[model samples]
Target: MMKNIQLKAMGKINLGLDVVRRRPDGYHEVRMVMQTVSLYDKVGITVEDQPGIRITANLSFLPLNENNIVYKAAKLLMDEFSIDQGVSISLEKHIPVAGGMAGGSTDGAAVLYGMNRLFSLGMGQKRLMELGLKLGADVPYCIMRGTALAEGIGEVLTPMPPMPDCWILIARPPFGVSTRFVYENLHLEKIDRHPDIDGIVRAIEDSDLEAMCARLENVLETVTIRKHPQIEEIKNFMRERGAVNALMSGSGPTVFGIFENERECRSAAEAVRERGMARQVYAVKPFNP
Candidate 1:
């Protein structure tokens, strides 16, 4: 009998993101505080007799073949572990694709973690994290999960104390924002300001939501909001409707608002949805792990 395992691939929100510089490798150097959210894609994995990979997802936008991160993760593991068995991966996506929530990366992380457990691969978390870095910069943080301070092209992670459980309202517009475009357009010298990630880290440690809100900032916000005015409008609306804090997540067309409880989050989500300005609106909580 083949082993089967199920795992939840959680999404992430960047509390603060600052692009420090562009690296020689064509990737932007960044300092960001990333927090996992309760919004997730559920992935199911079952070992197959043949040595190949397969993926299925309800979202037509997600690539189901080698282009899929889940498939890439499975292939990487098979090569590293010298496994002959193939895997069947199925994703039930709750997170929007290319919405700056690191959904695909999270799915890949879940696959790597679940496969290790199901197949008794004996690869430790550290080893898995190392492998994940080869897949994407965000993959390491996804593997770690919870709250983290990410730096240096987003591959370096320092795990932080979890943020207090709160409701999250995410609003994504109809169009996608290219992370590359945002980075390329950034005038590093002309960019007059940046966020204090260390300060945000301190506030999170102290569990001070108010202080955190005061410090919630993303340098990328300027670039993204310029391109998509709806992001700014959404943030303004969420604030007026009782959000404790509102900001864009990652290089976003998706903006998020924080609330003290589910009631507030639901109310904000409904308000945003009723406006019919965004592609999607979600009422979710921060992921504990």
Candidate 2:
């Protein structure tokens, strides 16, 4: 019999992101405040007598072979745990691909988490996170979902107080932003201002929404916004419509606004949609896991 397990692969937003410096190893050090959102993708995994792993997803463009992170996660667990059972993975994706929201990383994290439960592997969050880092820098944080502080190429994490109760309006424009382009063009010495990562952490601990929103910043905006001015326009639109504050998330074309009122959040979503500012928009709450 094939045993199946299902998991929710939640998306995350960066409350504040700062590029500390680039290392000789070619990886940049960063300090970021990460918050998980209610938005997620459904991931289903089945273990059976088959000899190899097979993957399927709702999106035709999503790769199902070993090139997929989900496949790599499964392979990692099977080889490490010496599990002989073959696996089949299915994804009903809702999170946008390459949206700088850690969409793919969360999906890979779900596979690691689901396999541990389905096979009764007894791997704790620590062990799972260790395995996840092998896949991607964001995978470790995705495994330990919630509000957190991420540093050291995004692998080091410190759980923080849950974000204050509020509605989040997420909007992603019709086009995609190239993360590589954003990073390659970033000159650390030229940046005038950096996000206050510690200050944002303190605001989160104090449960001060206004203070946190005011501090919300991402240094990459210098490069990304220059190439795509639409991002700044969206942020201005969200704020004018009733958002307490708004900022671009990750290396974005995706901008999110913090709204204290649910009605205001919904109205913002509708306006963004009506104006065709974004191809995808959603109103959701902060998710703590």
Candidate 3:
């Protein structure tokens, strides 16, 4: 078995997110197209002499115990496989926590994937995805990594085509958004429009950047933007600054713009930084690998 392995926990952005309806289980039935982006967290997994999982993170505020998804993933793998071997995991956080970036979910997926290789567990992708589902709804998609249409509380995934060629400019304000609160406050009557998923899919198939941008929408934005006007302000700023399309991702305070070129994307990121519109800014591309 390899003594140590490092994995990238990629982040995601929702091109379109719509709540279909409220389910009986208290979870909303959702239809959203989620895409992996270049922003990521680096996680290191190492074999240890002890007989349990130990987790440490560079971020001071993050819990290294069971509260962390990485710890939970390691524990789940050990228990499921009946392995006695101990493991130590360290997280170098790059993606913003609780910023609608799927940071925690991807970290959990990375652990499961890295451990499968580190311990030589011989678990295949299907089994890994199955196990990932137990950790979080987004974990399965993170393990798969790419463009996907996620439905049924974000667990049901159907692989979609690669996104159009463009740069993704992301900006997250210095504020936290509670996914639970956003979901709880979402009233279907208040939503005037839901995203056109089929239209976006057609645009993707045609590689039409403008059409894809035109169809960009998220129902969650109605609730999130109402609570934080800055989210909308950032969108307008990006749209005016050479971004063909802009929208908030997931239950966000993080708004991303789809820029046609690298120069414009970089300029927009720097401008957002200089204008104090965002706490964190990134100019990145879709993560195909």
Each prediction's RMSD over C-alphas, in Å, is 1.2, 1.1, 0.8
Estimate, for each residue in 1-289, the C-alpha lDDT of model 2 and write its tens digit: 3289989999999999999999999899999999999999999998888768899999999999999999999999999989898889999888878887999999999999999988899999999999999999999999999999999999999999899999999999989988888889999999888889899999999999999999999999999999899999999999999999998889987899999999999999999999999988999999996
Off by over 4 Å in 3: none
Badly placed stretches (over 4 Å) of model 2 are none
lDDT of 3 at 184: 95
lDDT of 3 by residue, 180-235 (tens): 99999999877778899988888888889999999999998888998999999999
lDDT of 2: 0.93
| Residue-wise C-alpha lDDT for candidate 1, range 21-99, written one tens digit per residue | 8888888889999999888899999998898998989988778999999999999999988989889999999887888
- How big is the positional error of residue 224 in model 3, measured in Å on the Cα after superposition? 0.9
lDDT minimum window of 10 residues, candidate 1: 1-10
Better of 1 and 2 by lDDT: 2
Find the 10 residues in a row with the least total lDDT in model 3: 189-198
Candidate-wise lDDT, in order: 0.89, 0.93, 0.92
Highest lDDT: which candidate? 2
| Segments in model 1 whose C-alpha atoms lie over 4 Å from true places | none
| Candidates by TM-score, descending order | 3, 2, 1
lDDT score at residue 167, model 1, on the 0-100 scale: 84
2 against 3, candidate with superior lDDT: 2
In model 2, which range of ten residues has the least summed lDDT? 1-10
